[model samples]
Target: MTYTTEIIINKPRKEIIKTFEDSSLFPHWQRGLKRSRVISGKAGEEGSKRRLYINIEGQSIKMTETIIKKNLPEEWHGQYTSKGMKSIQKNYFEALDDHKTKWTSQSEFEFSGFMKLISKLLPDMFKKRSVMVQQDFKTFIEEGKPVKTN
Candidate 1:
């Protein structure tokens, strides 16, 4: 199954792109992400790996993401692996105007067994997750303040 989500940020395309290219700030924009660390090299290089712990309800899941494609200020694609399940995530950015940016994120996963059954009920699980993350980023960029985490 694939999940996609989009948002318009009231910031220049460069600022929005910086949030994605600079992995050091992932925690500030991603609410579900509990922690992340680079494996291969620095933030913006291809083949760089990031292991993220995401909060799923009251529990946490560990997912390792490897960069597959990189086109700065344009596109980024990665593969996420969690519990032996692999998924592809794609992110794109477009300038809506001088100070506006449109961002879209897509993901496709091969789910099975219990997950397949659950996904049927939760139609927009990843979409919601993406939206939540983007909304936080919107706050970070527009307000110069991140969403408070407690």
Candidate 2:
């Protein structure tokens, strides 16, 4: 399944990038994300690994993400492996102006073996999952000003 989501933040490019790069900061804004841990290398650098545990379908799945590109204040790309499923995510953040940033995520993956058949039959399910995840981010960025996500 290919899933993607996007949002425009009202924060500066640097501030937004800081929030994205901070592994300990994910649970605060990332919806359904239980936690994130740095697996091996330093974050914001190529080859950094982050282990993410997320809730999906009332279940939890562990995902390991390897940084493919980590250009801060602009873009980040990574490949994720979760439960024998592999996918790649390209996250782009563009500064629309001094006070606005556009955040976009594009992911592509193939579900084979048995899952592929299900994905082919029910595309909306996967898309909805992606939408919910992004909506969490949107809520965090939009609401973090006055309150804490945690």
Residue 110 lDDT in model 2? 66
Model 2 CA deviation exceeding 4 Å by range: 1-4, 145-150
- Scored by lDDT, model 1 comes in at 0.81
The parts of candidate 1 lying over 4 Å away from their true place are none
Return the TM-score for each candidate structure.
Answer: 0.88, 0.83
> Which residue pairs clash within candidate 1?
none
User: Which tens-of-lDDT digit does each residue in 34-56 have in candidate 2?
Assistant: 87778888865799898989886
Clash number for model 2? 0
Error of 2 at 40 (Å): 2.0
Q: Residues 1-150, candidate 1, lDDT per residue (tens digit)?
A: 887889999888998887767666777777767778887766657898888898878868899889999996889898988773678989899999999999888988877777677678886876787688788888887876765652
